[model samples]
Target: MATARHARPKELENASLEEIMDRYVARYADRRADWAAFEDAKIEGYKRAQHRFIGAGGSGKHNDVSAIPAGNFTLSIMYVPPGQGNAAHTHEVEEVFFVLQGHLDVFVQDEDGRKISKRLGPWECISCPAGVIHGYDNNSLEPVYFQVMLGRGKPETMGYADDDLYKRRDEHLKAVS
Candidate 1:
């Protein structure tokens, strides 16, 4: 049995078969990745990919009818190759990472530059509050997979914590263009 916190809309309950099917189904094959946005072999050492199933994520791409648009939050899966991870960045909205496979080390940096990190195994989860500078790394030899849930339907752009890395990313883009 399933329950909803709020009553279901009469219109939705009475929707046509095709409309109902379209509203509820999302297939894995339809997923697309913005590999160039984050993973550039020359700019960064790690190769991380984000698969948007629910929303376009903070990058602002792939927000089409094909994707299940998020109303209050966004959900996506991340594929991180061994020895690959994300650069330190901050988000205006809360961000959560739930480990589904392999090992991951999540690091958090405070305003004063003090940093701390923790390791997450399968089925583990960690939440970084709004405006917290955090990043993830896969230290294991095996690839790591995790689900990312953001607090907002359309999150603001991520703020890179390291100024040098941010500048480097901009320069790299300019050079490639």
Candidate 2:
């Protein structure tokens, strides 16, 4: 007697074409910016928002869910207004930033507090190693846009390199609370 062939799962077999298509496509208009992740206008810098398309980055917020589920990495776009950017922070996984528009000044600081900065124009990219404290700044008058990809799907909260900045952030949170 011949055995029956294995059948596909019911969910997969019953899924509509549109459902499958939607899972693979993500439009820019459909994305929303999460402003709560970075700056609050209290600090001199650190005013940026992230648009997630692959996964919720290290922001520790589930607000942004990408159309494509992240397996080994997370992808997101960051919008940094002129003169504003993220503060120096370290991650356990590798983080890369690809400049899409305007100019960005990427900087990394060593444990001894020495910092090295680089300028990245459109189509430029920078990859920061794990546990390195790095940050970005848009010194130009025009706004800067960049794509950020972390090695891990679910990254941990960023560890600020500047003790003063961390303390100030904590104090600000306390005041608001």
For this target, which candidate reaches the highest lDDT against the unseen true structure?
2
Model 1: per-residue Cα lDDT over 58-140, one tens digit each:
54453446678677788888888888888788888999999999999999998788989999999999999998899888888
Per-model TM values vs. the true structure: 0.80, 0.80
| TM-score, prediction 2 | 0.80
* lDDT of the candidates, in the order given: 0.75, 0.77
- How does candidate 1 score on lDDT? 0.75
Candidate 2 clashing pairs, residues 3+ apart or interchain: none
**Candidate 1: Cα lDDT at 168:** 52
Which residue pairs show collisions in model 1?
Answer: none
